[model samples]
Target: MTATASPTHDAGARAALIAELKRSAPHEAAMRIGLEPPARAAEVLAEMNPAMVQDILEAIDAEARSRIAMAAPRELAAQWSRNAAYAEGTLGRLMDPPFATFRPGSTVGEAIENLKSLVRTAFVTYGYVTDPEGRLLGLVTMRDLLFNDHGTKLSEVMLKDPFALTPDLPVSDAMRLTLNRHFPVYPVKDEAGVLVGLVRGSTMFEEEAFEIAAQPGAMVGIEKEERIATPLFGSFKFRHPWLLINLITAFAAGGVVALFQGTVDKFVILATFLPVLAGQSGNTGCQALAVTVRGITLGDIPPGGASRLMAKEFLLGLLNGAVTGVLTGVAMFVLASSQDSPSAVMLGVVVCLAMMGSCAISGISGAIVPLTLKRLGADPATASSIVVTTATDVASMGLLLGLAAVLIR
Candidate 1:
């Protein structure tokens, strides 16, 4: 015979267990608790990371996973499974199944009763009105349902010609749409215009936050999926390739310096300025790269806009380079005069010209690298810094040294 605890004791024990599991054994605890009741499991899993939830679901036995899926709300389960099937950054992965939906003919009284039931179990922001074939027609808010006559049909009261996103839309593109007017929820339809899901503003906000947060790491070759909880080996695998690439680029910069060995030997001061030139040009390239990447991500740069963007960056680079180069040239002149060098004025001219040219080239390289990579179907942010840095280093050092050899010697 088993001793049974009172309802209060059972509730307390379950809460305590859930709290402990959430802190330490999130995956295991989710699996164990998710098996108890479908609604309860969905509720618990909803609060956890979506990626982790999907991982746990995939790792569990098929039978168990199926049961949990079945136990979840119809729309919630459908959305979760659909999102799992999509690539990480697509809009499909960011949308949830429409929790509250009604047919065009549904009466106001029926819609209200349905919402009353759904509100208890899940979030109910707006009720989607669909046709008999599941094609999205319009939307009805709770306020509309409450203020209207009870016998009124949904089509008569709902907002017509609603905005909808297709499943294949990129998450970044979806974000662009939400910037102006933030709706509480936006409908998602299939390519055929059949209603499939809802994208909550809150959910989209969270995904955008994650994407923005991941960018710094992404620029340095870190995988977007990597987190503090990622395994040591996983992190190693993600990081090693970028490090090796950096080493190769560093060698290329060194080789440029090696080619100008005579210039460095004749004027050791040129070697001292090599790093200063590289630093300025490299920062200029990075600034261009950052702005270009942002423009691409936000959909601000439309088709055929790349040429204009490049031109703008190049002109800005020229202006900035001229100003900075004059300052550097003055400094070099003062240094050379202090050393009583015969070619002090010529050295200043060479340095000034080299700085201007290097900066202009760096800016162009920065703007083009990401755009080129994007055209080649690669991620714009992936390894972009490495390529930009390498280009700037080679350009700045090669120009400064080669010019010094010709003009100063």
Candidate 2:
């Protein structure tokens, strides 16, 4: 008969996995623990951060997720299933089963007696009081339990109408609501205002941080669940399609150049400056793009703020482009004068005007693209850079060559 591992050995292995999970991001933790048997993986996930548990579960596949859930404790498995009932990026997905609850009529001594056993299993923060119907009444801190008379009922000591979060509240909105509260835990209620679960402040903050951190990658078409420690094939699978999309968009810019083939054939100097114009406008657009994405992520942008943002970026771009344009104009004049092109002075004017116009339009596009995506119920950061870059390229190149074709010769 094959011998099973000793209890001590299994405990040590599980302790090590917990340590590893603590050190890795949720996605990385999923990758690391994915090789474990379902039973082992479920045990490790159970001991993880509540918010991280949801993310790790999401990062794994449906078969694996189901297997891990099956192996998990009944309470945790139920919480996972309940969490799945809510939409992504909502507080419901990151909640934990409330522990240490008591009826309002319970005495301090009775609550203390119950906590003795509760503390042995879970890290209870506060004792929640609820109605017989399961609606939240209030909560009592450990301090209240310590200072109050043993005969004191929870209703006499608990803080009334304690701040709570709604289950369906967006994580971004949750962050805003809890910014001032900072309590270790907040009660979660449903649309009917019945208490259902508790979310830890740390877990909520970590989820928000992960969402923010994933955005820069999202702008380039990388999935939020991908991590540096992800399997090579997994990373390739997540990334390859976006790159193909980028290649297709690049051809649009290439076609614009093809349209200007005659202008380039006549004045080769314009070719040298094409990249310069595109690069400058692209940088301007990226500045606007970064700000817009951050605003959306933090819920900083007010409703109908897009038009004001676009106008602000456009003006900022016009002023910045003018300052850069003077220097670019001088460079063009010198390069053209050296080449003895008859349109040297005129070429300088064209460069200056093209730079200013290209940057202004690029800025508007950058701000508008993300705002449009957000309005369409898509991620504001999803491949936004690709869209902004393509717009900048076509606009910058078109403005420069188009102006030359019209005004120069």
Return the TM-score for each candidate structure.
Answer: 0.86, 0.92
Clashes of 1: 0
Instruction: Give the top-scoring candidate (lDDT).
Output: 2
Against the correct fold, how does model 2 do in TM-score? 0.92
Residue pairs with backbone atoms closer than 3 Å in model 2 (clashes): none
Which ranges of candidate 2 are over 4 A from the true structure? 1-12, 18-39, 55-71
Instruction: Note the Cα lDDT for every prediction shown.
Output: 0.81, 0.89
Candidate 1 per-residue lDDT over residues 1-409, each given as its tens digit: 9999998997686676556444433345545765577666666656554544665666667777787788776766776888788666677766666778899889999998887778887777899888888899999988998899999999999999788888787778888887887898889898888987777777777777877877777777887766665557867887998899899999999999999999888988887778888999999998999998888888889899999989988888777889999999999999999999888898888888888988888898889998998899877887788898999899989999999988875
Assess the local accuracy of residue 265 in candidate 2 as a C-alpha lDDT between 0 and 100.
94
Model 1 misses residue 368 by how many Å? 0.8
Which stretches in model 1 have alpha-carbon errors above 4 Å? 1-42, 48-71, 229-233
lDDT of 2 by residue, 130-204 (tens): 998878889899999999999999999999888999989999999999898779999998876677888999988
> What lDDT does candidate 1 reach at residue 381?
81
